[model samples]
Target: MRTCYTGEVNTQHLGQTVTLFGWVHRRRDHGGVIFIDLRDRAGLAQIVVNPENAEVFATAERIRNEFCLRVTGVVQARPEGTANSDLASGAVEIVCQELEILNASVTPPFQLDDDNLSETTRLTHRVLDLRRPQMQNNLMLRYRVAMEVRKYLDSMGFIDIETPMLTKSTPEGARDYLVPSRVNPGEFFALPQSPQLFKQMLMVAGFDRYYQITKCFRDEDLRADRQPEFTQIDCEMSFMDEFQIRDIFENMVRHVFSTVQKVELPQPFPVMSWTEAMQRFGSDKPDMRVKLEFTDVADLMREVSFKVFSGPANDPSCRVVALRVPAGGEMPRSEIDAYTKFVGIYGAKGLAYIKVNDVTNIPEGLQSPIVKNIDNDALRAVMERTGAQNGDLIFFGADKTQVVNDAIGALRIKIGHSEHGRKHGLVEAGWKPLWVVDFPMFEYDEETKRYYAAHHPFTSPKDGHEDFLETDPAKVQAKAYDMVLNGWEMGGGSVRIHRADVQSKVFSALNINAEEAREKFGFLLDALQYGAPPHGGIAFGLDRMITMMAGADSIRDVIAFPKTQRAQCLLTHAPSGVDEKQLKELHIRLRPQEAKPA
Candidate 1:
């Protein structure tokens, strides 16, 4: 309820009279004169009640932090010594002609600028927490990003279409959050994990292109970047192959990055196969910004005396790789121990390392406890392969292929952060984006003894790889691709399987027989028979994408009202018990919950 935003009034509006309504961000009293910082979402403006204005002065004196007020004042240049160059409204201050306190407030539970408060306490007072400038800026950036997404897609002839939020339960790789039905008692509807099937159906319905920014829910555990409910920028197209699909979306993201974040991502991001990514960086989502990469010493280690190196070297399913950390020879023993412990979380049994102390001679440069366990030939090979140098340290992970990759990959990222990209919660000046392509169509789940789709069941197997679906499922690669930025996967999609026979073969490879496949995805199978066009599209996690763009530590910082890692909303107290009458209306029965001891 004001003439203009606080930030909108600057030197250009000097001497103009205006009315502002906002909370008191900060209040200061210098002798009899009072100064208060009036804050709205746009930003903070300085207001001063001169001593001569007795009525306004008295009211300003009574105002405390966070007190809602309406002020009518004439904007004027601030005193030379009082100017704040850091703020948009810094050069001027409002000379209060009148001041009215619309509402009074007690002190906030925590200071807006203080960093010591726990996340729980901050979440409990989310309304106030969001008032902090950082949160406000994050949400504003999120808004701009979303709008830019719309602008880009619209310009590209993408029509915005909505899909059902309450749909039938389907296998979507995550447990669905079910809604009990009222009219159809004993039945349930599941919240859409994604509009995956609906979007495909849109393509089948002859909608050339479609896009939606919609909510998706999953009854899954949470993490720094995950939530019980999240937003996705879902899109689909018809008659476009994987190349055309990737080009359109890559340009869309580039446009958004240029428009929203003001960063121009490099065109035609370097592409690498999933196999190559795993081999070099030990992760399908590699942060190439990091100078670190692994060297395969498996061949040389096959005959070494060190069992830790030689044992895994001979196993076809295991790998012996080394990471050469620059200037790592200076790391104290305790740091190495801590690093060893860090890799342990990813299933690595132990960490093996060799410190390079001298560059003049290979044998003399090596200085590690296990130097005696490895032959000179093996040591020289590792040094040559990884390009080790004096003052560098080589860390080794020899285990099952996945475990080795996961552990070393994680270490590589951690080191990159500890050295660059960001420190604490602040990001630096550069970014790296890449396209990781050619992913395996299916992955063998050793625990379940079954193959699961790598990207999804709908992803089409490559032309020549279709035969391998039946003969060698492990070797079949899908025309799938992911857009990764600064180590986070911004989005992913693939050419979809439109042929029923190919779909059935994929289902069979995943061990889902004809009957089970029909039962779960009968509608999709039915639609394919009626003629579905060749199509592929991508879905981006808006939360994660915005988080990376904002350089935020977690997606929660970008989400308006996020739950804790336990998936409980502190602000709304969601997941609360329903009344007995309500449950009866939904035809539900109550079960006793086990009590936990304090």
Candidate 2:
């Protein structure tokens, strides 16, 4: 319908007559001359309408923001001092000789130029919202990233294969979004949380390398980084171990950053074990940008007369940890008290601290009521262990290990941003990638009083840990590895248990009885029996990767039709009521409501 996009009319195209189609981004009037910024997905081009072309000028004068227009114009350089340095087509303007107002629009609910529009209002008029330059750039960046990923994988002999969206429900990580089966009557098919099973099955089917940019659905609570449905760059490979898979994906990620974002990532990403990451940073996915780390003070506090520290230290399930904040000694008492209350959300009992006012004189420098009970030597020992310096503040947590880790880990990131005069910036230039390996095969579910697979049941236990599968599930580490960028878990995969015997052993450890396993995953076990090769693969959350690459605050910013916090799509008004006839066909009935007297 058009010869060129509005954004393509640049200084290079000056004096060339071209046809362009787009919505009127903005219209301006200076005396008798009318100017309009015409916008399409490519970007914007300034269109000038002079009285010399009376008919075209009249059409341009009537056009409002969002008016769909088609124009034939000669691209010309903007007059001196009129060039827009901020735009790609800054040096040029389209002098319209002809104009066609294809469609007129009312003033939009919210201005496209307004940055402070509420998300709800913006979503309500999403068509207009998407016309914004930033939103356009984000979507364009997303497309480039996806394309780069596909190209990299395809070059490495990975087949672009697809998996079923409607499959049998199995407990993967999240709750499945089920579709009621009309043919089967009362049965349901679930949208995949991931292509975890089918991708593994492709390995069994002898497709050594497979990849899919697939949509996954989960009926779970929404977060800034999550949605009811999301896309994943799902890939799996056979005859490869954890290290081999990690290396391939890491390069692919680097390729994506370089090609799409024009940023060259580090050559080799630093690797850290699950145990080390957790112990030092209190989180498996540690934001290396923050310099803060948690130091164990359990041993030092165990012998202390103070019960607050001593009690948790004595308990095997509990821990005592501390965070040393640089130049944080001057933090107000109210601020410290507020932080204590903040940790309460993570079930932390309270936050304790020792503010070091000065390092030259150890006794006088330390400020804490607890320091009075402990001698100077003990206080000095605590300071030395935490690597505390003058003008540093040490915050402590004593509780169950989970509480301590959750509270302190989150606080580190929060404080890294909130604390002024702190060295708060990206951990390193470009990308800092890592493969976190050696995750536990199973974590003991205290509530269920049973072991649950840490990653998934199909993941193979590390070599020599096979014997511990039944003996001590907790001691068995999976050959799983996660690719982490900064702090986000970009993707994860593990070497699968190709042997049915080993897979069965894993199932047993996860408290999945033979009958239940057969019911849920019999196809997988049956497939494994027929020559399944040693394979592993990773699936990157496409939204998250794109969001991070674009430096967006949340994954929602990158998604076109994102859901609200409650997982409702405001644009589509989804999760709405169904017609009675439609419900009847599905053999469903709405529950009756109580009658109210009028």
Candidate 3:
């Protein structure tokens, strides 16, 4: 219906008659001269409908925001000082010779440029919301990223293969979203949490290489970075060790960034072990941009009179970490108390700190309640260990190892991104991608009194760590690597246990006996016995990747249709009721809610 996009018209096309089709982004009439900004996916172009052309002027007068139009005009240079330097077609304007309103629109619920609209309103009217330029650009960037991934993987001999959506319900990390089968009464097929098993099967089947842009479902608590259903760039390869797999995928990500974002990520991203990352930054996927780290003060505090520091310092399963916040001595008492309250969220009993007022004066200049309890030598040692300067604030987390790491680690990030940190130049700019490897094979659940796979059961133990699988599960490390960008885990992968015996040992370590293992992962175990090749792969969270690239605060912003935090789709109104007959056919019955006592 149109010869060119509205945004494509330029000064080079001056005097050229062109046809355009788009929705009216804005309409303005000044001194009887009508102007309409026509917007298409390409962008916007200004149309000038002079009153001298009465017929076209009359049509322009009727146009309003979002009115779909078909226009034929002569592109000409804009009148002096009337050009829009901000736009691609700003140098020229279209002199409307003919105008046709293909469709008219009622006033929209909210303006496209209104940034403060409620999320519910935006989601409910998603079609209109997506018409906004920022949303359009985000989706376009997503399309380009997907294309780049395909191009890179295709060149690397990876086959674009697909796995099943509905498979067996194998309970693991997160609860699965199940689908009831009407034909097989009482039987349910769960949506895949990932193509973890199927991809491994492909290696066993000798596919050699595989890749798929696929959707995965996990019925878990929602967060900014999470969704019930999300897309991943899934991949797998045969005969490659963990290092080889990391090299290939790392290059692919660099390729993606260079091609799509025009940004060159650092060559050979830094690699840190899981233990080092937790101890140093308190997070496996540490944001290297944050210029803060934990310093050990356990040895110095072991003999201190204050039990708050002495107890955890002497305990084997506990730690005493001192985090020095530069220029933090100036922080108010209220802010310090607020930080103490913040750490409590992570099971921290309390937050301890010493404001380094002056290094010259030991007990008198130092400001902290615990200062008097510790001897001058111990206090001086704590200061020396942390390199606490005259203007630094040394925050302490002395508790169970996990609690200390979680509390201090979270505090590090929060402080680094806070206004005070920015004022002190704590957060650095640009991309910081790294590989967080050497994750423990299993994590013991104190409540469940059982061990769960840190990555997954299929992941192979690190070299020479397999022997510890059944004996000391905590000592075993998986050959796992995660691609962390800034602070988000963009992707993760690990070498698989190709040998049947090795797989059985891992299952046994997790307390999954032969019978239970057979019931849950029989297919995977059965496939492993049939000569499965040594293989590994990574799955990039596509939503998370784009969220970082586009600088969107949440993955939901990049997604076309996203659910609320409660996981409800405002637009579709899903999770609705069904007829009793349909439920009977599926052999399902609704359960009434249990009433609470008055």
Candidate 4:
């Protein structure tokens, strides 16, 4: 018999007989009648079995929760005053003429409808957990998002191309998860952190446009937004600069928002330079939902008697900045102390504040334990610059410029959510998309005392900046752009260096000696010499983008079988020990644990 999805049934099909197959969500008995809520991926349908059909009623009586069953039933309208408004087929019920149990499940560890189960427990039985409506919806949304991405890209003449997952490793980024080589005995193959190199090669190979929804693996510490293996909607195109690539991707994103959420984003997302973003908000990715902004107070602090402010202000590398929280003057001393401790996490020694009770009266209204030692003019200058009005509090961070930015930047986000109560609702409803361009080619790593590529080695320096490659690498800007939505970095890409000489120079500047560079990226360098094109591409974290669009806290919600925080598959218990024979076949020896002497 042909089967129909339970959720597809509606009142329009009343009096029509249909075969429905699903799991029994719940069973309710009322003397002569048994009602079963049959659930399939489509939705739920209430099935009624009358005692008059003694055989079917007997079969229904033995049915329990999660019992897989197929039932032939006639759809009929519910009795007067018995309709359920919560369900799509609420006004109708199915009368079962025949019942057959396809499979029976033992009682689940927890009820499928239970919302209180811990994530660990749910992950342990992911198949059962996925049966829940929420999980089903999440996966369905993910499918729709992926489809939308493919449709959008394809319409724009982008080709969906597949890249090799088993690719060689490159230096200068996160650690790679290596696969044991069976034939090579001891040598190993590394999983691609991204399809970065291959995609660039495709551009050089004259594939004008290429895209892939592929898996990438990175052996790194896990966070809410990270996994050992993840998917990216990788795209690359030839003869395109950073602006063109950014525009295409932004349009694609806007298309997804319009099609999926039915919400229209602004036409042009506001743009901010890297230096501007850092100076104003102390972060590259500043959440615009918050109105609070940082103001430089270094000049004002230069003459202040407070050494905490003067010490940092006097040093060239140090910075002193203040952030004003409006209507925050009433914040208790304990709360201020708490914020002080919070900034310490980012390397700030302490937090200083001036609570402005009244803006007009400077001396009496401005209250700060340390302000008494400062000149009134200096205090007024800070208040005026930060726009500190009545009932506002100005918090200051002083230290090395990096520390000040990190501490203040994180505090701004924390205060926006907790104190200001700004992070509310889904979608933030504002389509703030922008192309953050002209990024520095490299960042100086203090610990290593060397400069590393800010994006990657392949990124080409801006037109005029190429001359400064050896003499002043710091002044060079790359042809790179990051696509930002609201505050999140959706994706980033850059025009690559097509010439072999420039590529080698970038390697040299990154301190990758000739021998090491040849060893790690000889293939790429070789490929560059073979009639390469001026090409650039961008990659969007498909899971992250979808998760944000789906209004989920983490990308794991949208992924069907995501790994846990420790990068272990809970349902299948992956990353478990393998049999000795399997290891031997791979020509590997297990590392013995050290024995403790008694």
Candidate 5:
């Protein structure tokens, strides 16, 4: 129906007659002559319909924004001084020979160019929302990123493979979305949280290298970067160590950034151990773009009269650290109180600080309520340890280890991106990619009083650490590594437990008994009894990667149709109740709602 896209008409096609199909992006009646910007997926081109062509002009007069059209025109250079240098088709205009309104649209709910449109309204009118130029560009960028990943992985001899969506559910850290089976009454299939198990099975079945751009699900609470359903670049390999796996995937990411974004990431991205990451920055995924770090002040505070500092300092399970903010002595009292409130959200009892008004004068020059409680010598040690100079502010986090880390770590990032950090030029420019490795094999949940897999159950313990699996799981480290870009963990993987015995030992440490293991992962256990090669793999969050690439705030912006934080599809109104007959077939019964107490 069309010879070329609207945006494809340029100076090179001048004088050539072309048939373009698109929506009327904008229509302006300049006195008698009508002008329309015809837009397609490629972009937009201006179409001129003069009254001399009476029939086409009449059709153009009835055209409105978003009206689908077919324009047959002769391409010509746009008039001098009227050219739009911003557009690819800027230098040319299409002189309409024929204009056909394929479909008319009602006045759109909101203009596509309106930046302040609410998410709810945009989601409700998603078709129109996607018509916006930025949306088009984001989706196109997503496509190109996926293609680039596929091309790079294929070149490295990785086979593109498929994994089942509805499969047996094993705990992979989150609740699964279950599907009821009509054929088998009371039985359900869980959506794959990841292709974790299936990919490992592929390795045991002797597929040397495998990859999939596959969907993953997690029936957990949602956030800006999270979705009930998301995509991951799932990969697995046989006989490769952590180093080999990291090297291949790192290069792949670097290749993606270079080819897609035209920006070269560092040749060898920096590495930080998981322990170091948490201790220094209070997060597994540390944002290296921030210049702040934690400074230990426990020893100095041990003998101090202030019980708030002395109490946590004396306990091995607790930490007392200071974050030295350069030139932050001028921060107003209100701002410090606001930050104290922010830290309170993470379970911090309070935020303490000592403003270094003069490094030369100790107790006299320091400014803080707690300074008088702490001795001058101890204060000097605290300042010296943190390298606190004059006009700097030393913020302290004193609590149980986790709370201290969480509160101060978050404060670091917040301050780095805050008005003060920007005003003082603390946040660095450009990308900061790094590898966080040597993660603890398990984290002991105090409430549950049992160890949980730090990564996943299949992850292998570091060399000779298998003995500690049952004895001291806390001491064991995993052969796992995560690829982090800035502060986001782009991908994570580890060496798999190939032997059946080792796999059983890991399950035992997680407190899964033999009978339960047999029930939940019987197939995997049986497969492991046969010959299984040494293997490891990684799954990169495709949405998160594209989100960073496109500079979008949320993963939903990159997705065509995404659920809200409540996980509802506004466009389709999904998750509506099913008919009784359909529920009967699945042998499901709806429970009556209980009355709420007043």
Candidate 6:
């Protein structure tokens, strides 16, 4: 129990005797006066002890970083020039009349202010790591965001409702984390990847509007922005179409940003279709802050003698995209090679380029090893199409449509933000919120020769495209929309299929036959048949949102207990072996491992 937080003490509280409790952030000594920085989640406060109080001074001098303590001190103004101008409590110090060491700490494995600590070490000592001020602030910001989201939705007549975490698993793209059933032999319940099905069912049940800040689990590979278990601001509504849903959530998002981050986001974010985004930026969730963009050159290169560009250009399914970097000709060849290697990771065969130095002479103007292979006419056409000015470097990506989009899109962001782009005046410094809509209902996997839902099966196909579902699934667009902040996809949703026939058609388009559909989603189909209302909803990655709001690089830093990239909890040593008896109860058995020789 404490009367005042460290960062709250000020001139107004001078001469006031108050009780404080916190860990000693740091300890210092100047001659006979002992100083300790007491820290709480509120922030740090300076506590000074003088030889006048010999016992308190002795106790303060013994304190070290992370030593938990309780203190009774008289607040007083700091000596002139000794004030910390950067701190809220800089004007005053707590003169400790009493000091009680509640708990002593062993030296931390790493200091609180230490930079570049390995993720493993930080995670292993997460409790101490969480005590760091930045971590405290991030988690607090996360809490504030959740509260504001709930408030905004609540004001909009959205009821806070919960869906079951343990439910039957039907494929929703990613693998689900399953819970073995003890009562039912050879059965399992899955942690929801999202409340997608349940939220839609709620609309069918006529809840009108429902929202939940729920946990979602996926047994998938990890990344900087992902966790095996994550949170979503899940929502759904009945009798609402795409525009209404988008408007409501957009305002909610703006409300969240304004209230929590003190940043006012623009109303009605910019919109682009899935096709346009892919063609120009190579990503549905494109970062508009970066100035680099792709221009189509497939047609111009189709008749060229160079097979590298001509081969893909001639194929209708492939694409050829060029990115013009302003004043990029000055870049050294080594940097260009490094970028070529970077694009190769995205299945690019190679990055082709022509450096524009002097446009006056067509042949002598360009400088690149590939310049000889590119016909002068084709080169001139590309230069004209891309508006390649002098001192610009035009990088080309030629491959399957998706491959070119992925590689060139990624290259755009990398080059636009890289040192060269900044030097060339290409990188812009601002945030741009956008909406990427009209996603295709199905994306055909050329490898598997099967069509998968671009968003999810429940997402309704756009009107009149119902015919395209049977005739041409590739051309079927969905009434889906995604909210993107700068580059990350903050949230996405679509109008749901409230009709049984339509839902069944979506299932069939995804290669799910009637019998299998009944086995997997019978309840949903049956519900649709019985008075399901037209509805739609969105799910925002709460961790990802908070990560951006807190300016944290990884979602892991904002999470209190995050698993490793390999999905192992370093602190708890999770995913440890289960005893044979427990497995027997769940009617499961594992194959025996071969004996190892000692």
What are the per-residue Cα lDDT tens digits for candidate 2 across 1-598?
Answer: 6877778667778899989999988899999999999999988899899998888877777889899988998889999999998888889998899899899998788789899988889777777788898889999999988888888988999999888989999998889998988777788999999999999889999999999999999999888788999999998999887888888988998888888778887778888999999899888888776777889988887778889988999999998988988878768888888888899989988888889987657678888877776666667778889888888899998998999999998888778767442553413344667778899888887888998888888888899999898788889988988888878888888888898778878888888899999999998888888888888888889998888988888887899988888888888888777677776687766676632222
- Indicate the residue-level lDDT of 159 in model 5: 98
After superposition, candidate 2 runs with Cα above 4 Å error: 360-362, 419-430, 594-598
Task: Give each model's whole-structure lDDT.
Answer: 0.88, 0.85, 0.91, 0.85, 0.92, 0.89
In Å, residue 258's CA in model 4 sits off its true spot by: 1.1
After the best TM-score superposition of candidate 2, give how far the Cα of residue 182 lies from its true spot, in angstroms. Answer: 1.2
Candidate 5 residue-wise lDDT, 1-598, digit = tens:
6887788778889999999999988999999989999999999999999999888888888889999998998999988899999999999999999888999999999999899999999899999999999999899999999999999999999999999998997888999999998888988899999998899889889898999999999999999999999999999999899999999999999999999999999989898999999888889999999999999889998999999999999999999999999999989989999999999999998999989998889898999999999998999898888898899998999999999999999999999999999889889988999999999999999998999988898899999999998798889999999999878989999999998778888999999999998898889878877799999999999999999999999999999999999999999987677777787799977775632222
Error of 5 at 214 (Å): 0.6
lDDT of candidate 1 over 4-72, digit per residue (tens) = 987667998888999999999999998878889999999999998898988788888899999999999
- Predicted candidate 4 versus true structure: per-residue lDDT over 251-352, tens digit per residue: 888888888889787776677788888898887777777667889989998888889999999999899999988777767888888989999999989898
Q: Quote the lDDT for 248 in model 5.
A: 96
- TM-score per prediction, in order, is 0.96, 0.96, 0.97, 0.94, 0.98, 0.98
For 1-598, candidate 3 gives per-residue lDDT tens digits of 6788888889889999999999999999989999899999889999999999988888888889999999999999998998989899999998999899999999999899898988889999999999999999999999999999999999999999989999999876999999999999999999999999999999999999999999999999999999999999999999988889999999999999999989999989999999999889878999999999999889998888999989999999999999999999989999999999999999999998889999778988899998898889988887888888898999999999989989999999999989889999999989999999999989989899999998888889998998898789989999999999898999999998888889889988989899999999899888888878899999999999999999998899999999889988989886567777888899987776532222
- The collision pairs in model 2 are none
Candidate 3, residue 536: lDDT? 91
At residue 573, give the lDDT of candidate 1. 86
Better of 2 and 3 by lDDT: 3
Model 4 deviation from native, Cα RMSD in Å: 2.8
Candidate 3 structure lDDT: 0.91
Best by lDDT: 5
Model 1 Cα shift for residue 108 (angstroms)? 1.2
